[model samples]
Target: MATQTLALTRLAASAWGCSVRRAKELYTKVIRSVLAYGASAWHKVADTKKGPALSLTTVQNSCLRTVTGAYKATPQCYLETEAAVPPLDLYLSARAASFEIPTETTGKLQLLRGACIKAAEIINRERSARRRRQRRPQGATSETPVTLWPSDAQLASAKQWLGGQTVEKALKEKWEQRWFHAVTPTRGRRELAAESPPDCGACHRYDDMLKHEASVLMQACTGRIGLRSFLFTCRVPDVPTPLCNCGEGRETAEHLILYCKDFKESREHLATQLAPNSLRTRRDLAALTTKKDTARLIVKWLLRTGRLPLYKRAMEVGGPPEHVNLFRP
Candidate 1:
């Protein structure tokens, strides 16, 4: 059900001017809220139970990984607690408890109260049966007496007890984890070279980025856009032999920005804006993304060349990838 919301959030990201926080906010309001709707009713059911929780959790983890842009191997425990998402069982039970049974209808409150009592009765019976089946240790301490049903007070204060409150500190810790993930060291220059490029540019507040920015940077930095070489490599039909339109050489990113005559005018201006000859080599052009002025210069060139927006249009027209987001007001 929430599968599409993940795509929706990516669209929302660009709509909200490529803001990651806005993307997360949209996730909370639209996607997460939908998943949590009517949660209390089935929270304690088999699907939410221990050891065999259903795809509810799996789907949630996927969205959160989308939100934080964490690597796939990030632990599920981290995805939940750190991602500011509640456990399904706990959330459902608490949410169910939080609401007062609608009493406007005749006997509805009584029916609701009766349902709670029945649920509590079932829980107590199961626990008792399970406890009886277990072997006690030689010197285990005496257990507390179990209550079969919740008190009136427990029902009234379900929201508080279940603790749906947002913890700002926990969120900070979560962002901290994301930050750490972004800056985690790699094996050195060769490994860096083999990959397209890292977001070695100035860090975004979020580890990854909102949908639009992430998609653009992912390809631009990684050197995997639909340029001539990429088309030729894919054997795209009617593709010319991977040559630059400028007729000087093949149309690689470095060649276009560094040597192609087409962008030489803008390139010269950008070069003047940057330090002396810093962008001479392909490696330099890629690595210069880490420098503030140099990065700005590159952005100007890409903007002038229509590369960024072209890629952005591709991403939008091509349909958002699995983990993209679009922000909303």
Candidate 2:
């Protein structure tokens, strides 16, 4: 379990240490599949019991802590909310409910939804329980979770435990974070895995650099690099002041790469490539999604400014960044 969740250290190691948001996304993409295969069977079983000797909650909490880049003592609620992790029972019921009406965009998910519903109905219901005279979706399908459990009852237990917050609302939130940002239709499930998938923001891009100078530079464009404050959060030893050597203020990643005075000369040539908003503020920085050209500009500024070496060294110590050094950045 530790190995699976802690594995993010590799991804975090780039001069761009992973941010809390990015860590959460990676946790879902990587660790989630590892921890929850065939999860439905036990997802609801022991999730609600307080501190069971070995509960799914423990595993989830552990993973949540790792992804949020939070410490052992951080509040579980904060971690869960930051990571957009639904409460345990809520997650399971959502899984069960998804089968009740599958999200249609992803072919694979649709199949899984169909299987879970059909399998559960086949296994739980008596052969005679299938009344051909009753209404069914596909001519003569088995009773669905909605039919077996009332629409209101399905969420009753969840609401009771969650201080009246409906599973519908929680699942709706999960749909955006855990699933893609989908707009649920008034009458039916909205599309996910968009026909034109929104490109990843740099903060969420993940690519392990293997070799080649351009690729390394491109990998640097991945929003994996962190700054002084982030490294300090990771408890990196020998950290200098968060303030930049340039003396402007705290050395944030955006300032270091895009807006610092010390890098002004270096950034001069590259400045031509920047989107007007790219060099503006932190939100602009976070919004700098997947334009390979923008990464080139950032890396160019880093190299020209001579901060690249110090930045990479700090990152290596903190997360042990994993770019293949084909060319000298």
Clashing pairs in 2: 13-321, 15-225, 16-224, 16-225, 16-226, 17-224, 17-225, 17-226
**Candidate 1 lDDT tens digits, 19-129:** 445555666687767767865444442213343235566766676556544434444544443334554444444445544332413556666667877887777788767
Whole-model Cα lDDT of every candidate shown, in order: 0.51, 0.46
Model 2 segments more than 4 A misplaced: 1-31, 45-91, 99-226, 231-237, 275-278, 290-292, 303-329
Let me know the TM-score candidate 2 reaches against the reference structure: 0.44
Predictions: Cα RMSD each = 12.5, 13.8
